[model samples]
Target: MKKIELGELLGQMTVSEKVGQLLQLAPMFYKGTITEGEITGPMAEMGITTEVSENAGSVLGSTTASEMIAIQEAYLKTNRLGIPLIFMADVVHGYKTIFPIPLAIGATWDVELAEKMAAISAKEATAAGLQVTFSPMVDLVRDPRWGRVMESTGEDPHLNSAMAASFVRGYQGNPDELAENHEKMAACVKHFAAYGAAEAGREYNTVDMSMRELYQNYLPAYTAALEAGSKLVMTAFNVVDGVPATGNEWLMRDVLRDELGFDGVLISDWGAVKEIINHGTAANSVEAADVALRAGVDIEMMTTCYLENLERLIADGALPVGLLDEAVMRILELKRDVGLFEDPYRGLKGDVDRQQDILSVEHREVAREIAADAMVLLKNDGDLLPLGATGRKMALVGPLATTQDVLGAWSWLGDMKDAVSIEDGMKAQFDQVDVAGAMDTENVTEAEIAEMVRVAQDADVIVLALGESANRSGEANSIATIRLPETQYPMIDAIRALGKPVVTVLFNGRPLDLHGLIEASDALVEAWFPGTEAGNAVADILSGRVNPNGKLPMSFPYTTGQIPVYYNHLRTGRPADAADAQEHYVSQYIDIPNQPLFDFGFGLSYTTFAYSNLELSSDTITKMDTLTISVTVKNTGTIAGKEIVALYVQDIVGKVSRPCKELKRFTKIDLAPGEAVVVTFNLTEEDLRYYKPNLDFTSDPGDFNVFIGTHLQAAFCLA
Candidate 1:
């Protein structure tokens, strides 16, 4: 479909039809067996008629194939131009064969695996009848209180950007999957413009940050997703800089469209167009429609505000007809681009695919590989991990011990029955396994603890599963505190007193305050909800099959008081290290240390790597120069392991104060024992850029401290 043809098609639409094109309704609007009264449920209250529902441009939250095909066939029968409705859903991690949550995917630090996961998700979702997925949430997060942290990659801009691009590439596919065969779904990069910066980590709270903060840190991932060919960008629900993002012209039009060069469809998050009135920026739904339309939002999702008020806005001259035409044309063009007009039943072969290939043996293998890589070793005192399951009997204890709740939140399409539990995974490898604990506290009584302790004491070792439930994280489930539930403490204390090898396999969505368990356990594995193959993946790490290689994308705090701790903090004027360690006037916490329990880019492997001879091609460089950095990493342990070599830059002098360290480049490489690899990073002038004092997005010339470390495992072999 050419631009003129799409525009002409838009021209043919009546004002009512054009308004209908801007609305995206849920499955309830189109499902056949639904009652008429129920069908008019919310839309009628919002002044939208059944006519608008029948003519809506898109549908979300649909899972069945026959029903979706029937809805489209029925709609096209009465439609004049015969346009196909694009189906979209929240295919966050996977469709049926769920992978680890986004946060766990971030822990893997494997761009290839991230892409693979997105590809599998797109394939499975398209097979089940979706044309798009609201995924690859690239929000950079620092606070763990936000439940949506599980949906995000992590706190670092560089890592999040890399992951975002990989996800877009995977979902949309290189050379375009829709162009190839319509097997892949269009990717929708979401919560645009610093949604993770919600005040005090509250969900739907206001986001207040400077333009420099926005451009420098928060906006990179969204731009990267756009640059990587995502077909849509979803507006955030919260207000940014005193204006709701769905109605902010500078945010949606100037920043997202003009600055980031996103020419794709811009859709509002669920009911966000209506919520603009609640933000006090719009007086009512009529004004909210006017505000959102003029702000460059192409679609109003799950709301009748646009359907009810767009024509009114145009008649009153509050909205330009060209804007509505443009929005409608974009929808038609996208539908055509995805080959929906060519075949409305594009990826609807999932029922057969499900029987043959959807979540087949090959997909499970990929999930297993990703799940293993996503597991991070937070602690391994005395090298107690990699303990074989056969030689010794192990007791698995915790709320998640035997439950199939391993798939974290946002996997609405996934079936929990298909998920493998920890007990199941442990029993496969270990000769004898004793399972305890419960997903809810109601089942975990004192009698349960006494019995579990008796069984656990007889075992040679204990594998304790711990962490937050799926409902505790993801979308509007933010928490004021991030400690493990107090109910589980009695069980933990009982297990600790057993004098057995106690290893904890944590299964939470966000980083938790691990001050108590840090000393209680022999080993701690941060397994943030590894999906479908969760049991086997952790079992692989517990056994010697796969060495731990994952790194933390975000820092783990010692306590909730140090909530926002990250590696790249700016240097304090009155630094704790600036004076004597015992000095009272220094900027130091009286009760706790001023460091994270675990730093960003921090991880442990079964083997060790030594970093030596960090060197630079030149001390400084001009605009025309490219500085080269090199560091030698040696595998010192007997077994082979993967090491993540990182390059951090510290600007010694700048017009604006800079972070103490910023991650520029990192690479994960596998090394055999006694083998060495010299990792090199080329730094061009663009790598040194930051938002200047005058807000110029250019690099300032100055001497810099080039820090190179092998996953921070080396204090420096400085020979």
Candidate 2:
């Protein structure tokens, strides 16, 4: 049936029947074990014609296919209306074959590989009885201190938008695939509004920003996801302009539904609808339901706010009956689109052959390939990498050298036993390698430091793996000081004193203050939690099988005081000049430099690449014209390597102040000895536009500067 025709049918249903569409309850069973009564009893009593089981609504931690199928079978057989439930899970990164975190994937700057990774994740999730994935979190997070930043694409809007579109396409492919096994699951582009720019980088904190900043800096990724055919959007936990996001009609209805033309179902984040009472925006559960339903939130996840109060709110004249009918129609249309109306068990099947595809060997290989590309080479002074295995005696030491902390953070449903440690990879490479455990499981000691020094005395090279534990940097894991633990610093200083060419491998979720380590080590690799295959991928780069082409997606700060530093920040009107700057007055600090430890797009290669003069197709253009900016890149060093040529643009005389440089385009190219290539980036008027005070997106014709290089200061131009 047509969607509008389905809306008319839902409008004829009673008020109690309309409230059933909003309720999503958890199931109480495992396999054939019946822990609680049938799902139909309570649902029938409340006049709920459409009810969702726990296994159908959202999967907690991890669940088996057999258990999920049993629950769905029971729901279908007992429910009066037989409205099939939609299954959802947090399949971020990977489902069973774990890959690197999202931030690490952004560092690779390879959209093709990221798209393939999501496709593999979708296949595995569908095999595990899931119809939806709450993934491709495209929020642009500038604060590394935020625990959820590890789940985002990175700090740039343009990069996030491109990656988001690729993920949506990969998850929901062409029409033929959608017909094959109900094709693919729905892709949920999450945190509907500004949830990343929280106060002090704290999770679920209040957000305060002008509308201009919201549209230009943060809203682009969500908009891109909608255009890519996303079926659902999850609301954030924070408030915008003193109104909670779960209850904000302007964001959910006016902006998303009216302005952007997004017709997807809006779901609350976890229990955000019930959380509005804690935000002091609602008096009780009934008021929370009244606010959320009016704001156009169609699904209430895990919270009983909607199930218990929506009917009362409608009867009391707080919520109109037409709104409830509209929400039920959208929900029913999604059910039919997924083919659940034809076959109730479309997503869940107990067939052993289908369950075997969840974590196949082919999926694991793709996980390893993506983890290797995500590794960013932070510093390599004197080209100290590509360790030779013929005659070198290497010493691998540190707390996390052989531990499971390499799995990174937000490894939901990921098995730690399958992860590879750095020590395992290094030992596999060479025959004469010595492994030494220098610290206790929980803390480091002085005796451990002495043992590390003694072990490195006879070795030709030292590989030190150091970073936080898995629990130290995730949610509720914020710290006042973002530095290496005091205990580990002694071990690092002791190993550096041995003078045996030290190479530091860092495993972290966010950027750390690495000033002391940079000065002590000959080389550094920022391997941000390369998931299941972390050890093997790091070994490949260390043994010269693959070159490190990954760049920093987030800035590495020199100190903790530069907590919120980024590359595209606006310049002040009276920027301090070094000649007249003093510690007492200007934006200068008394003790530290006002620069990052490593800038964005900063990474070293085994070989070097140089940029030549830039040429533009034309010097002047109108709003409808296009410009082609080209630059020549040549390999200057002996070793063959890959280089990421970046293009940045600046609007010099805008009505509002802009950033010093914004990344417009970038390309990664592989080069051989003495090889060169001409990289071209096309510019459109849309790339030059920014949101004004009134949310107008247009660029005024003026002199614009184009920058092309490996770093930000490579070349300059006027167009």
Candidate 3:
């Protein structure tokens, strides 16, 4: 388990064995459950022999602790060095007791809750015998059309960086004691370096950006995760500077390893190593293997390039034998660090009872609580929410009214049948509740509309649950338009014609262009695919048992044409002023305003909050001084609520162009009616620092504007 022992084990491994250690295959190869024909078909296609599978270093995904235990036991008996196989899976949000998606978690703006949820995910994943989770995806995105935007925290580097560090802390626990902490697993911060900036918001599209933009906006969250002691890093599928990330030596070695100082195991996304050939960076698998290894990819996932060509390349003297040795040593070091050498079956020992730990009642309670806080009240006109003891007849309609598909993408271990339905939650609260559910989003019939109208005509209020299906978002599922499906518009129109108070609950993954839906509904709630206790959480918010406190992490665009709308944008020379719209010689859209429908950090609570008496400790301060900014925030409405106060700073001048505003810090506070508290934040010179044109991160001394909650502004000078 020590360094000397790891070296001795590596020294005993043959060339084929060393190559096999750098190859990660699926569990089916080691399970031996398939027929010879089935095995040979895939093996021949991948150009890997059964022996490669026998000595493979890691398993992609094993379903249960028993399966992992069996696989590791079988693999060690045959492996000459007896190195254990590490189990890894995309345990993104939750394992079995599903929580809200990462985007919804971001809306909560509660990093503590995010960390707690991640710890619960680790608890469940470790019960299933996974040692590594490819999660805490920290890619910052401004485009909502990209399906993977749901995986990232948001567009801001600060929020994403904080969330990334919290996830690493929750998953890895203490870096030094990670091997003994069986409840936790090593976190793998993934899709390294600007994957969210994919061109056209398309999956796997090319990413082209300036080095200044890369260092300033995209790379901070990854660096934050590594600083928090993440044990692994996964390469992005897209190219950086015209080279695939898996094969870009400058990117992986120079930036990620040298600059960021990440000396952990670097693995490629599934089949990304072999796909380097398709990127035109390599001619064949042999070249692909050589290129990826040179780029410092420690493991090639689900690909035969490393297994098939590494040994030959080393023998031909085209590649250094030390490259292979370096990779194998890192893999072994990880194996030892995770206690695989000492225990072999870390959390998968005998008497494994998955049911006791998988989805307990306590886990579901935490899921419900988090889901409730993540629900954003986008619109609450006329105070229609908190339906309370009104004794009003309620009707639940639309496609998602009674469905259990609330668990969003990447919930591989969660079953839809286990999800709570809106109808179930509503019926538990109301004495009289009717339901006319439409299951199809793209195909709604006149008969179905009539059925919905007939059911809701007698009801005093309609709770319309409408959204894109679970498959419409997440990896490989990008849409052209960021609006509701056209078919659902007919139902919305029908429900509006009934002349009843309508409350629409959206179960989407991304920020939608809510043009028609907003007009048709009196109240709107962005539920965002609440998991497990989805219906119960929505009912809690609607019934006044819980208050809506979530805020938007990404901006909701005005239309699909405004694809990359975000709050933090550069101040151009001729910026269009809203006060002088007639002065149109500047950068303004002819048909639409440049602003989004909803800005970042926008959300409504059941109660109102008033900000007053903005104060700065000093009007001017030197670079070494920390300026204290404070504002008194009061709960003006007649109920207790939680408010997320944000702090933004603008650098007046810099060596390079800067955004008009950038979020530096934010905090959530709970206040009761008539209770006011002074929220304080200290801004230092380091907080104003940014990437210069020459890639130096430092601040410029100049005049600056500071904003708290978007309205309270104060000016200060750094002399």
Candidate 4:
């Protein structure tokens, strides 16, 4: 249906019917039928009646093709206006064929791979009868304590925005293809606004930050995703500027709709609309619905606040009829955009190769490539990796070696049995592979320790795996201490004490506190939960089949006390310029060095890269001019590998103090051994812009420092 026809259809519905379209329920309605009226599950307390249950606009967390077909077929039988129920689910990291987590994808620094992963996810989800996915979470995260960092791309706004736009492009495709193609679904960029900045790194905690911080760092990714044509935006659970994001007008309307030009449907995070009452911004469900509608949230996800109160809110003149109609129109228009109105099935009710598409050979190859690309070699001394030396015996020991739970959190549909473990991968390539106790125990048991030590001593080298479990770092699983388990670190130390060359394979979601692990192992690989193909991908890198090229998207804090550490931090009057310069006057810590263990953009490869002879089109640039800065990078090692060329700009003088360095642009380029390439980056006026002290975005033309390459000590001055 067109806009006018949709509007006419909206006009034909009563207030109760319109409100019903905004309520999104779970599978309870279809468990038996509306006649059963089984308000037993989560919907029991929501006061859902027969009418509302039959009329819920969409279903959440249900992705099976037959199940959705059944729900939609049944819903249309009773849906008064004949509006089809839209199906939405979380295709966060991946569907059944899981890929690496968002953090691992970020480590790759390969937007193309990230995009391909999203495309595969969209294709698999669409084939399974899902029309929309809650994905591409663009929250700019810096704290690893927040368990949801696993969902975010990384700490940098630029990187996160690039990944966010890629996900939107991959999921929705172009506007032309998005409608008719079931393989392409609507992308929902979420936890809109700064949900990642939960204070104290606690889940559901209040987020209080300056407008400058929000605009400079947090808002870019959300804005980028919407600009890339995402169909929906999910409201965050935390408060921004003292009001919950679901009910904050400035956030929902002013920033998202007006400034960002997002006219698509705006959704609330699960039960966020009702939780506004707990935020102390609303008195009850009535006030919650009133405030949320006023804030312009279109769809109330998993909440009865709107279902029970929106019509009465309109009766009390708290909400206008036009506003309600506008929201319903957006939701209806989204359904139409997905071609749900044209063919309610979107071509999924017919024959489908569900298993083949979900776990396709081509999709598994992409997952393997991404997993290989995202593995970061943190420490490799004396070329200890690649295991290229002949007659090598690997004593594979540690907790994460044998587990198949490599698919990180939010992968609700990924099958653990399909995952490959480090042990499996190593055995595929090596001759002698000894496996030991992979799970931590209460007491080391002298016999187990003796067995592990014997294996370690007998082996030519040791490959030890260690990290948090799969459930350690996604949503509501925040941790105050991100250290390895009490027993795991001791195991690493004990293995190191064997005097064998120990290689630590770190499998984790967040940037762990790795001060001890780094010191314990001779070589380290940060293999953040690589999905179903985790073992093969790590084997590719570890067995010299693929070179490790990933970098740290977020900084590794020296200790949990050094939370919120990031590379793009603003400079202070007396910055701790020295690594260990702890003085009473300067901003330094007395206990330890004021630096991250693994800095952002820091990663090692088997092949070394050299940067020299930096050149710029012009040393002086104005608002109207674009500077083409080129740097010559050469592979200085014996192996060929990809290098992430990063461009960071430091505004030496500005209206307001800017970050010490902000990543403006970056690209990944591959160079053969001893081969050189001139990597060029264009610095436009937009790259120089920053939030002024008075809140106006303008750049001050003055001296600027430009850093190129991951080893960016060769700084160039610009005017």
How many clashes in each structure? 0, 3, 0, 1
Ranking the candidates on lDDT from highest down gives 3, 4, 1, 2
Worst 10 residues of 3 by lDDT: 31-40
How far off is model 2, as Cα RMSD?
3.3
**Candidate order (TM-score):** 3, 4, 1, 2
RMSD of candidates 1 onward, in order: 2.7, 3.3, 1.5, 2.1
* Model 3 agreement with the true structure over 1-719: per-residue lDDT tens digits: 78998888888889999999888888777743445566677777777776788888998988688788777877777887778899999998899999999989999999999999999999899888899999989999999899988888899999999899988898888878878978889999989879999999999999999888889889999999999999999999999999999999999999999999998899999999989999998999999999999999999999889887888888999999899998999889888788887798885665656548788999999999999999999999999998984589999998998889889998888999999999998888877889988768667778888989999999988999999888889999998899888989989998999899999999998999999999998999999989999999999999888989999999999999987989989877777874655587888788998999999899998899999999999999988899999999999999999999999998888887789899999999999999999999999888888988778888787999999977799999988
TM-score for candidate 2, please give it.
0.93
Instruction: Supply candidate 3's per-residue lDDT for 275.
Output: 95
Best by TM-score: 3
Q: Compared with the true structure, what per-residue lDDT tens digits does model 2 show for residues 173-291?
A: 75224534543777889897888888888888889888888898888889988898888788999998889999999988998899889887788888899999999999998889889
RMSD of 3: 1.5
lDDT of 1 by residue, 1-719 (tens): 66677777877889888778788988777746466678776666666666776788999888866667777877787766777888899999998899999999999888999999998888777777788899889999999999999999899999999999999999988625484466688999999879999888899999988888888899999988999999999999888888999999999888888888878899999999999999999999888988899998999998878877788888988788999888887778788778776687785643445434467778889999999998899899889889976777788887788889889999888888998888888788878888876747324667777877887988888998878788888998898888887777788899899989899999899998887787889999999999999999988899968899999988888889888888887787788987555588888789999998988888899998888877777765677877777888999999999887878877777777789888888788999999998898888888888998678988665577767753332111111
Candidate 1 Cα misplacement greater than 4 A, ranges = 31-43, 175-177, 347-355, 439-443, 580-582, 710-719
Q: What TM-score number comes out for model 3? A: 0.98
Clashing pairs in 1: none
Cα deviation in Å at residue 520, candidate 1? 1.1
TM-score of 4: 0.97
